[model samples]
Target: MIKHIVMWKLKNPGDAAKFKAQLDSCKGLVPGMREFEAAVRTEGLEANVDVVLVSAFDDRAALQAYLEHPVHVEVSGVLGGLRESRTVLDYET
Candidate 1:
């Protein structure tokens, strides 16, 4: 399996709710997602990223398919507007 993890820092910290909603929306749109979770730093911890996304896929190809999917593209479009910085990691189990 492949685990795709991502973190994002929003342009406006106050938009946390909106960003999290977008994350859930994106997850709902993904067809082959084996698992998906979104989290926000509720503890007000000092961190560069405001939100985190942890997703699981069957393999690299499935992960790639999700990345190329149109729904994901649309989600990214929304995220691009709201995010100030982003980082990602993909690995296999």
Candidate 2:
């Protein structure tokens, strides 16, 4: 299994709600994705990242498919404008 995790630091955490809705649109849209989740940091948590996406796939190819999907492309378009910084990690178990 592979886990693909991404964190985004937005220009404003208040604006992140829009990005959350965009990400929710991708639920069950990506091929070969076993699981998908998105969330934002809570108040008083000292969050360095504003949004986080955690996804699971059978392999790297599955992750790649998700990355190349049209739905994801649209999501990226929205996120790109909102993000100030981003971080990502992919690992297998």
Candidate 3:
């Protein structure tokens, strides 16, 4: 399986909910999506980023399909406008 993790620091921290919601919208968007989770940092958490997404795919091809899906592309555009910095990691597990 492929593990995909993304952390984002928003241009405006107040928009974290919107950012998370946009990501959540992509759940079950593509075939071979094993898992999908999006979360906002807790109020008292010690973290550098504002939001996170942890997902798993059956393989590299499935991960690629998710990345290229139209719904994902649209959601990414929304996320792009809201984020100041973004970090991503993808590796086989």
Candidate 4:
């Protein structure tokens, strides 16, 4: 399986919830999506990132399909202006 993880630091921390919700809207967008989860930072945590996503796919092709899907493109559009910084990791497991 392929695991795709991403963390984002928002331009406005208050928008974290909205960003996470937008990401959640992409769940089940394509076949071979094993798992999808999005969450905002904890209230009193010493974290710098505002939002995080942890998703798993059957393989690289499945992961690619999800990235190229229109639903994901829309989510990316919403995140583009709101995020100050973003980091991503993908690996086979």
Candidate 5:
């Protein structure tokens, strides 16, 4: 299995909820998407990042398919402008 994890620091922290909602729209959009989750940092937490995504795929190919899917592409466009910084980690499990 492949795990894809990402963290984002938004230009405006207030936009976290909106960004998470937009990201949630991409769930189940493609095959082999075993798990998909997005969350914002809890209130009063000493965290720099605003949003995080934790997802699982069958393999690298499955992860690639999700990245290239139209829904994901559209979601990325929206996220691109809202985020100031982003980080990602992918690994087999």
Candidate 6:
């Protein structure tokens, strides 16, 4: 299995919830996606980023499909415009 994790630091922290919503919209958008989750950091948490997305895929090919999927491309385009920075990790699990 493959795990895909991403964290975003938004230009406006207030948009964290909105960003999480956008990320949530991607749920079930592709096959071979095992799990999809999005979350915003708690108000008092020691988080370096505002929003985070965690996803699991059946395999490396599945992860690649998710990245190239058109729905993801569009959503990511919008999300990309709102974030100051992004960190991503994809690895076998």
Q: Against the true structure, what is each candidate's TM-score?
A: 0.88, 0.92, 0.98, 0.96, 0.96, 0.96
TM-score-best of 1 and 3: 3
Best-fitting candidate, scored by TM-score: 3
**Residue ranges of candidate 3 with Cα displaced over 4 Å:** none
- lDDT scores for all predictions? 0.85, 0.87, 0.95, 0.94, 0.94, 0.92
Please give the clash total of every predicted structure, in order. Answer: 0, 0, 0, 0, 0, 0
User: lDDT score of model 4?
Assistant: 0.94
- Extract clashing residue pairs from model 5: none
For candidate 4, the 10 contiguous residues with the lowest summed lDDT are 41-50
Residue-level lDDT of model 3, residues 12-67, one tens digit each, is: 99999988988999999988999999999998869999999999999999999999
Tell me the spans in candidate 1 whose CA falls farther than 4 Å from its real position: 28-31, 44-46
lDDT of 5 by residue, 1-93 (tens): 999999999999999999999999989987899999999999887887899999999989989999999989999998999999999999999
Error of 5 at 42 (Å): 0.2
Compute the lDDT for candidate 6. 0.92
Model 4, 1-93: lDDT tens per residue? 999999999999999988988999999999999999999999887887889999999999999999999989988997899999999999999
lDDT of 6 by residue, 19-49 (tens): 9888998898878999999999998869999
TM-score for candidate 5, residues paired by index? 0.96
Q: Clash pairs of candidate 6?
A: none
- Angstrom error of the Cα, residue 58, model 1: value is 0.4
Reference-based TM-score, model 4: 0.96
The C-alpha stretches of model 2 lying farther than 4 A from their native spots are: none
**How close is each model in CA RMSD to the real structure?**
1.6, 1.1, 0.6, 0.8, 0.8, 0.7
